[model samples]
Target chain A: MAVYTEVTDEALAEFLTHYNIGSMVAFRGIAEGVENSNYALKTTQGDFILTLYEKRVDPADLPWFLGLMEHLAAHGLSCPLPVRARDGKNLNPLAGKIAAITTFLPGVWPRRVLVEHCEPLGAALARLHLTGEGFAPKRANALGPDAWNDLLQKSAPQADSVQAGLGRELDSMLHGIVANWPRGLPSGHIHADLFPDNVFFLDGEISGLIDFYFACTDIYAYDIAICLNAWCFEKDFSFNVTKSRALLRGYMAHRALSEAETAALPVLAQGAAMRFLLTRLYDWLNTPPGAMVTPKDPLDYYRRLRFHNAAKGAAAYGL
Target chain B: MAVYTEVTDEALAEFLTHYNIGSMVAFRGIAEGVENSNYALKTTQGDFILTLYEKRVDPADLPWFLGLMEHLAAHGLSCPLPVRARDGKNLNPLAGKIAAITTFLPGVWPRRVLVEHCEPLGAALARLHLTGEGFAPKRANALGPDAWNDLLQKSAPQADSVQAGLGRELDSMLHGIVANWPRGLPSGHIHADLFPDNVFFLDGEISGLIDFYFACTDIYAYDIAICLNAWCFEKDFSFNVTKSRALLRGYMAHRALSEAETAALPVLAQGAAMRFLLTRLYDWLNTPPGAMVTPKDPLDYYRRLRFHNAAKGAAAYGL
Candidate 1:
């Protein structure tokens, strides 16, 4: 839960004069994301989300994120449509930060992931990958394989401060992954951070997908690997085979996996686990004392990575 | 920003089964208040606020706070009405804590208070006191004059540690206030914590008053004093006479102040400042290291207390 910047009502009123959305009736800072300051805004016309991009988000990547949401919404995938201003620009400036308003979507992300949740998530994810076929903008995943070594270098010095011998273990795992990293396997736009909290559900069906800040061109199978790590694990980090079967089968119903994509699942899943592990490790080490946001335990992903390392093939994923 | 307890989707679904409000659509924890976990809940029926009372709130006083809102809303004062379930109860247990749903009020609280804000605030506050004339339930102000000595005792030891001789100054001030505290100034239900953030505005009008947890039967003049301390002070701690005059005039337009009330304004304002100073000092000293909520500077109220100490009479408050 984060609201790093406070926007005054006078400044907000002045900002709204540029838009066609009528006067602001209400606006509330939403305690949801860590990367941006978000407000639930209601106006004379309709309800929307006002997002102020914080320093953590690159200003250069703002257009890609906004454009991806617009493209996906236009292609019939449920997501926030950026509320364009009279100047035909969705992104504008407020309180010395880039800000944009988007149409409010109505659905809650599933808190306790059930088997029922995995199927629709799988189907919507496939649709997202398919609909994002020709999006004009391109964003390379900043946290992709090429970035892992630098992240590990920064986190390695103090990695064992959190756990004994953890740094050496991570170094060995990184060496193995770099040696066997998959290449040239069906690249497309992927929601690089498709965690359970980013997917919304209504009436037991997937209502929408959000937080496209991490969307970038990557191996589509890697996106699936992220979901398998996110949705198919229990609180105790135990793998749920039934849920995995449902998620994979549901995805197959929309887009069949190539044999190469199938063979790549275990390594992709391992890499996905490694990706989150390194980032979480970095955050855990760097978060200042008494920071507003709490960092997730890096060991949670370490546990997931261990599970993926032992898997034989897609068969181990219940494919 | 506080959301101490996370309510799972399954628990929320079960909690909603008791209410007539249709299936849940969306809910996000709001980053606004300090007392409880508040969520902006949307359903098929309409928008509402779902509050889960944290340990800071006394469980015994839940009914009083909820009932006061119901009473005030029913009596034509703009406020959030507690929504009763099919069981005819507004308060119920959810996630092992007491929770309730209230009708959502549509307006943003003023981020920066203006002189124009004070008049409507004064008039609405008077209306609130008038409408609360015959409220069936009565809750004593736990932070009233009687509680000041105890609060001082708890906070006094560390007071001088914060500033040289501050504890002795507070001790003398407490002695004078205890001896001269006003009585019989037309008491009624008061929104004791009417900070700018607690009042909502739309179209330059006071749309609603919220946060009734601090509402109690107290001297009506003291509530005005609290407002003077809150709304009529500039960031540099100087009094704004124009805003105070407009506020006082607006209140008189609704209900005239008696001679005794007018005479007691200076001492009452001093006590009001002392009340906040003691509590804030206690919180400042006792707040756990690395706690999420930052305690407000006790010295801010100490500055207000000094200003009120030098005030001559009602004229000092722009009467």
Candidate 2:
């Protein structure tokens, strides 16, 4: 783990003074994440999460994260509400890191997820997409196709070894995607990293969604593609069409996809697969030993990429 | 994107002093990564790469990264040789971050990989597995089954909403895999990441390999499984038995699998598929918007998981 900066108890206490919470209790040295240092903190008023800006998180991007949380909260989205600082600011500085406190959402992460949960999640995601309209942020999609090409170049020197074949495939795939790229879907603020850990549930209902760090402007359907990748697969890496339908139906209930968006689902799915495959590939190649962070298997994404390549239409997704 | 620490020209100059490389003539920032800051540096002596410990890299793990590089270089693996410090140490602190410089290998990443490449890659992977026999600096497999379970827990809350029957199916699959988990196979250090970008080629032959960060102690055949997932699939994600055969032949040429290992290959591939599916699922649920990282489609892995689940024997892989 990279401990770029540490928040001392005194510093945390002082920083908490600015918040509207009644009292402060802090847990420091939380897990090291790529984007933020998250501490589980408690206050007299309520439990909250204190996030220190890790090196990977740009200070300039803090407002977007904070504002998105506030926006989602304001729109009746079940999510953590950012607490204001003493100066009435949602963003604050603590221990040489940009910091913020958010109301802690309550729920245990599910031990075993069931098929029935997809509908609500799909609905919630659609709601999130709808709520993201008009959200003003300066940042753009970070992991778009151009960025993938650049990553390939960095790893290009080693491309011809046994695995070098993947580079070629990825290059061609990227070009294919670009040439046939879908244009002009409903674009909005997207929760780019809506992985399971970031979502909080109460009973069977989604009580809260957390971790808005990777949120950015992109095609709305792309988020659905992300969810399809996330929710419609079994443990053995098999696609469950039933699950795909449920998820898509759930989303459609809240916000219907345009004809173009529906048509682009398969291609979008392929792009999504390529995106992850490239990242996993990059991580697999560059991850150093003993970094504590695990690099995901590139083959996983490779398999997904291949599937998307073969997929004929969005009908497979029931979109 | 995350400049955890800036490396001054002087610091880079100091780094070059110990290496037998020539003058530092060029430095280019690689903008593709979400983890570290990499600069493609050219020295009068030869081309090299300078990697500054960025967000995801732990400073404490610098020695392990450096040592691994040195070890591989010593063994005639055509990888980057880390330049040691003036104190004869491979690890060193430069600027505010730990950094290392390594000799660059030669090769262009293939723009399109042919099925023929699989043989060399498979063979190279087998050689890598064999050579990893007693290499020191032990590390645990990062994303084994246990990690998959953990991700399941995290993503469980949204299970019902994301897929219709996926949660139940996933649960069943997990139970099945756990119950039928293979007992044993040749275990050793495995290059968990055998993706194409990490391999270097000269002409049609593999010249070298790079990126040992994800190397860990695990089942050797699992490494083969990873390679199969990476190399044997077509653009449309269908299994190519011909490619699979060539890859297996290459792998067998270097390190013949035990009967037990061969017998376990299909199941191992299933497990590999599941591992990827789970991670992709997790990423799908948690991706934040606007981040440069792309979330992969879970369905691709899901289908693969199903294929592996149905695969009854090693012959399925043309072995």
Q: Which one is best on lDDT? A: 1
A1-319 per-residue lDDT for model 1 (tens digits):
7788888888898989999999998888888888999999989997899999998899999988999999999989999999999999999999999999999988889878999999898898899999999796778989988899899999999999989999999989988887788988998999988898899888888888999988899999999999999999999999998999999988888989999999999999999999999999999999875677878889999999999999999998998
lDDT of 2 by residue, B232-290 (tens): 77667788888888989998988878889888888788888877778778877886643
Q: Where does model 1 exceed 4 Å of error?
A: B156-161, B164-168
Model 2 CA lDDT for position A162:
26
Candidate 1 DockQ, CA atoms? 0.65
Q: Which runs of model 2 end up more than 4 angstroms from their true locations? A: A1-5, A26-34, A159-164, B1-319
lDDT of 2 by residue, A239-258 (tens): 77788898888989989888
Worst lDDT 10-window in candidate 2 chain B: B25-34
Residue A242 deviation, candidate 2, in Å? 1.3
Model 1 steric clash pairs:
none
Measured over all alpha carbons after superposition, the RMSD of each candidate to the real structure, in angstroms, is: 1.9, 26.0
Interface RMSD of 2: 22.6
For model 2 the TM-score comes to 0.49
RMSD of 2: 26.0
